[model samples]
Target chain A: MQSPTRAKKKTKATSMDIAHRAGVSQATVSRVLRGSPLVNAETRRRVEEAVKELNYKVDRHASSLRTQRSGTLALLLFEDPTPDDSHINPFFLSMLGSITRACARHGHDLLVSFQQLSDDWHADYEDSMKADGLILLGYGDYLAYESKLAHLVAQGTHFVRWGPVLQGQPGISIGCDNAEGGALAGRHLVAQGRKKVAFLGDASTHFPEFFARYCGCDAALREVGLRMNPALQVDADSTEQAGYEAAQVLIARGLPFDAIFAASDLIALGAMHALKEAGLRIPEDVAVVGFDGTPMARFSNPPLSTVVQDTSKAGELLVDTLLQLVRDQPAQSITMAPTLQVRASSGG
Target chain B: MQSPTRAKKKTKATSMDIAHRAGVSQATVSRVLRGSPLVNAETRRRVEEAVKELNYKVDRHASSLRTQRSGTLALLLFEDPTPDDSHINPFFLSMLGSITRACARHGHDLLVSFQQLSDDWHADYEDSMKADGLILLGYGDYLAYESKLAHLVAQGTHFVRWGPVLQGQPGISIGCDNAEGGALAGRHLVAQGRKKVAFLGDASTHFPEFFARYCGCDAALREVGLRMNPALQVDADSTEQAGYEAAQVLIARGLPFDAIFAASDLIALGAMHALKEAGLRIPEDVAVVGFDGTPMARFSNPPLSTVVQDTSKAGELLVDTLLQLVRDQPAQSITMAPTLQVRASSGG
Candidate 1:
């Protein structure tokens, strides 16, 4: 006599259900589902497992459409400042890779546009589609783009400036602890018992990276009761050839610095070439240390000692910071610690 | 007043208009727009110019939807390979770069997947999506996921294979003319009166590259009236360390090779390093030539003489070929010509 009709079981888990299960807000559950790093990994993994078990499928496009948002991000890189060897600062390269990977894991993709200072420049085609956010790389002279970014921000566009931000701009940035890295390098050299030390840097300004390294080195030397030998500190053209010439000039002047700190690994490697050619033994005759530990640092004849920036993590952080801004959340400016990888040349 | 109505304006330009302007057929216009190489360069350029001038946007997404096809292409690369340095094969790197660029230019983005053979793993995401086509990097005998590819193909997913096809399937391949490159090296050495010529390469089977190069060298040596020297040939692991060790082995054997041709640039560069360490005079005692012509080729000391393959062009071609296959159109295999870049290392 009982009716055969039984309640149909629920088909799939929804965001609210996942949220309740994970003991987090629905927004946090959504963020976890979207692979946004704003949520801690433990929470995210739990949410993801729940999603898989529940066989939940979120219609991202529909939600984004309702909000009139494209759910897409644009990566704008300055093609003009591309170094001579097309050696994009490993920092940017690693950052781009991380950002792209992060975006992909979140079921989104980046529309990349490279702009150069050359003639025939135009706004990126995707500009009309209006991306949800932007990851700006080396967009020098933020003043020129201030109105552009301000307009987007007013329109609810979220973005993170991956490179240095201009003063007075309401934005977020993630960069390396350049000053600390510099200080680490300086202290390493000073600790090696080099009473006389020189600083060789590339021709760069405005980039917090170079300056931070310089300042760190400066402070460390001051703490160690030593100052940069004015006669020995020089700015090279930032090429291997330039480093060679700088070393040659230093050697020619008979500057008796027992140690040197170069701003870039390329320059340090180049300086090493020059020093070796001049019959000077590395670390023994003149201890040399470089910043930005590239793969080349290890393979060098005696190996190079340098400060390493976690480029991939920097990239991930840059994207994470940008996404936070996109979601109308606050983002703290972050500076990553530099890793000291000591090799033969740095007397480690 | 009754005749005041204006004729309805055309909403879009048809393929006919593009073909007419480009002096080709509607079919040709479609092919050109799809990046088919069958169209002559001038014709393709005309069609492209017309498409740009008209601001014609090919809604590839909508078209894929209409055709009930997945518009995405899969680019499968080894996540990691032995002699990790081999990953720097400029040819493959260039091809990857080109394919990515081409896909973007054509309003498509590649779904890149890493296949590590040791894991015997398959990509479930790509398989479920049934990618429109695949552009695979020819490396090792990683087991093939044929059932997956077959399933997609059965579902009307047209596909194009790059590099050598597996099991002699009717696959289209685009690669550098390695044999020709090899012959060029052989002839150059013979012309310089090198009686003994050594060939350094990696694995024999996976190295279709080495085979191609060897073919060219064999031809060149025959033309130069020189016999092959089996004693001078060595197949080493393709790594800097391997090259270094191979060089030592070659020298210890006291084989009189006046010239050497390494299968890849890394091998050549490594060999050069070892030779330099051994105090052998380059070009005088052992002129060296390298294959693949990676960008690093130009930067090597003595500026390594190499056969340069235009990686960007290769990238463009790979995309073009894949698009053709995606459209259910006939695709042709292509060989990119490798040009000999004469540098000091080969004594040229």
Candidate 2:
């Protein structure tokens, strides 16, 4: 058998060739190639078989020029505060899967890369016609990253970000209702008869997602005729070690806190470790709740109660929104609803 | 600030233009653009500045035609037995991070996609010149996937996979010393006075990695004058749920086991969950050990004891091997040494 690599050196196969082999009209072959629903299943199968036999590839560059569309999207993952060199947060990795599937569904290839905030990274992918638009995920310190978003905006780079849907933000964003997620955790803890709830995450304007979650938790406290104690709030980056240290700090302060609301599951896992080490029984002494229903939450010592961000919806919306921007359509920011998953740690 | 997207409509700046602006020869600019290390830091910086100023791209298609290189590598992740729709194993995800970094270091853009086993998936990417070569990870049931590997080899696809290094394997592969890792776990468990050991995972030729691990465990047992009881072996796929079910099946068989060795960390976690649910204490009633030292292992209820595959080295090796193939260099299979990370579950 001739090596396919060597075989490719010959004249490339075209859709017309596939159509001739499949005994179908060129138009039918085109419909199958475009993944048009108008094509019958048997015909599509025949065309696909013909394509496989001939090893035909649609010339992406030629098609891109003709349609003024690259048929590719770039997923730029900004470096996050990770405990290790991986830099990717587990939550974003989950989102990556969804986004990849969503892109596949929409017949687009994805170009993934790590984005450093310091570099002139924004001037490459889309500007070079490598990708039609960009989907941004996990920007550490939104306040610092906001200027870069404005820079992208001024450059007319079609893009969408997965973050807190703040009014007047520089670009279209698709995010979970972080405030509602926080409120869910807060309400659950409060109903469990926990008076003092500690928030363990960077809760400031600089970190809009965490800040929104904090606000929601605060609102829940207010609803119960209680208020979040300023001293109970410990600012920590989204990491297990940071969460562990934050929990230790909270413990050191001699504050009477019976519950904790971590902005992320990683933080909650670390806090749980610290609480266990400190000889505090979960739920009996302190109830804990976390956000982002990562897989780790399901397998934690006592399953973690967390706010489940609908990653499937988020992925579809991100791709849809970015595609709209690529088409010069007016795109708007969308906030997805969050669901609270009550597990053993939350005394459910 | 003109939108970069809009500005892209103008003729792209050329290397000659950058050379003129930087007061260097076009060859020097080309060397800098190609990421040749021969260029001095000052000269490279000057050329980079000129590039930024003129918004220059090396015209990938033109360069590709001249060099027969796309300057891109495709990282194809095969679907694994995942508990959720994500279909990604955490261990491979870590490798993905390392591979991405390696590609960037080599001045190659990485195009990542999930591969389904049953498809003409191999006909695209490198065949279309979208990527220069491929780095494959995760193939569930190697026996079934072996034909595909052979097909890839027959087609002369320049690719490398992460799997067990065995004789007659179709292509160059980079894998961990699974047998050695299993022996390490076995020796540790034996030292802790465990006699009857249960092995969770398919221990057969169909799954070479797990089979190798089981073989090593058998060797360790032989050294201790104890033979592995065939009845104690339970077949399980890579997922946690599979592990959980495997553990349950082992328990139901009424086997007298003092230790359990899982093929992967996910399986170990699931087995641990099952054992705990059955009211058994880890490292007391039964010592449990797993392979693949993922981040989750560090935070598992009783930090999991397992074998740590050097993902960094694996990534570097896989990319280097694939590049060697792309350059028509003879590539050899490599097996990285695995280190045993003895944690709480192993009574370390």
Candidate 3:
């Protein structure tokens, strides 16, 4: 093998080199080399010709690997054993875009795997020899997968997980400032004189996300001189339909809530739709706020006022943190603060 | 080398063998083997012990190659160089989610590579002996990466792309019916008594997606006893801000238009915001219909009426198509039809 210094010197084709030959924005040149579709065809052709003529070979992957990366990150999503994949929320889509972009910026690629709770495909898994790190998403009794993940950690694989890390498992976990977000919602509703505010969450479990959000709401209610209304707290599956059904059930029980705070944007949208069908004017008859600054929030009817966590930043930071850990660098569990984006539904 | 059959049948506890030993999904076994975080710790332990006891010697580099597979698919995204991974349209996200789901269901992983119009990251690409197939999404200009892709095809790599098959490109192209989506948008706006409708699309000189959408809208208008008033055709750079500005320009020109058909959900959402801020009521004031059944469409203020394409099917079809091509089977282009999802935005 060549000396490390010699290899590094020989492989240097800096961004400046490509820019000089391509005669475009260094950013444009980077985009060209990154194979982004943002540029024009004419520009791409010129850049390619320049690259071929200059013989500029950029070992993005090797460098990433040397920096303790296999130059790849894995996104492990829990697969539900069902035929219909329609129930999937768009949050994954948004998160994926951010994660993919972050990987590209660092000159790394993303590898994704899905874990379905089935038996026939096990024969296909003996080939697990790629990737330097991982970012785990998805849910549904992933205890078995978490155990294997723990083993990988024991074997020194660099990884970071969002949501809950397996009980006391060693890994970096990043999540939204759920407590703050919940408090923001609670305060906003109370400020609008909504004494009878209701809390709706997607899951019944005491996952950190749900618990934090719930706690924040409780704290906010306490601060605002209100009592925690247990009867107003409802558990709904995090879906638009579920939100609608939950709201319907509450209405049927003769609940008189002036405002509703749902944990997710999808659930909020569904609640809004149900409220509309029942001839209720948004913010006039009842106000609503949702968490998850999903793109859907911006476009929701009356637009949803919700907590917008910086997903792109989160994705970028997650990858960066994992990369640093891979390089034997110290890392911390990162939590991003959620911003309250006030919209029509939230009395903006 | 030993006879191919002998090599394949050599005694090694394959994933299937281990899966048979432990009653679980094949995908789960692959997940555990890959150290996915979606499995339970107990199941992972069982699989790990099985591997150790059975002496499963999995050759990382050779497994995918030996089976003529990387057990992974490549996702080629055409992206613009944006600070925050430019506002990804719902269509792309929907397609990506479906693709990811399909790869998961079929016991395969996904390798995502973003190819911009002006740059080429062929360094890592050259070494990515991984990935048995490629799924091209949001690739605007085929010429940028088509040749390299062609070279790979000639070298007997199996891949499938979305959208039109490039002239002389050897691969499968599975795409949503752009023409149909355009027609549906046009028809919806027209049916709502909106006469002077304008078409907003992304920049088309570089990539063909916008152009295809434009052609489809034109065809629909022509069928409905109308023609694009040339002056009403607007092109923005495919950002919310751009869409907002385009609507302003159109409004400033006082183009005789009572409707607007934006090519993407993002563009449509921007246009809606711009129109609303300018005191235009949705549907009642100027009906709007967007293409791409993004989740945002369902949540948009007044709920956007748009065209929904089956992205999951597209992903699955791409994989199946590539596998067939790898087997030297004849595969044809698949065009998926878009269904019109009526919502409040279209005044439905």
Candidate that would win on TM-score = 2
List, residue by residue over B1-348, the lDDT tens digit for candidate 3.
110111122343467877777777766778887678989999998888777766564544434434434566687777655424635766776677777777777766788766674565333342344555566666455556567555545444455678753344455577777777877877777778777878787536455666677777777778878876768877775567777888888888876788888877777888988898899988888888877677677777778888777777777788787666545567777778889998888899
Model 1 C-alpha lDDT per residue in residues A1-348, reported as the tens digit of each score: 111122232333568877877778899987876668798988888888777666555643334434545556677666544454334444344455556656765655565545553422222322333355677765343445556555444434455666443344444566667788888988888888877877776424534556667878878989967776678777764456667778888888986889888877777878988998999998899998887766556556567898987666766787777677656556676757888889889777
Give the Å shift of residue A269 in candidate 3. 1.3
> Which of candidates 2 and 3 reaches a greater DockQ?
2
Docking class of 2: acceptable
Better of 1 and 2 by TM-score: 2
| lDDT accuracy of residue B345 in candidate 3 | 86
lDDT of each: 0.65, 0.84, 0.69
TM-score to native of every candidate shown: 0.63, 0.88, 0.78
DockQ score for candidate 2? 0.32
RMSD of 3: 11.4
Docking class of 3: incorrect
Pick the winner on lDDT between candidates 2 and 3.
2
* Candidate 2: share of reference interface contacts reproduced: 0.24
Candidate 1 residue lDDT tens string, B1-348:
011122232344556667777777888877876777787888788889987776554443333334445555666655345334213344454555556657767866565544554543232323333345667664553234344444434434344545533343344567777878888888888877876788887535555667668767877988867855777777764566667778878888886778888877777878888898999988889989887766556546677888776767777788887788666556677777778887889888
TM-score of chain B in each prediction: 0.73, 0.88, 0.77
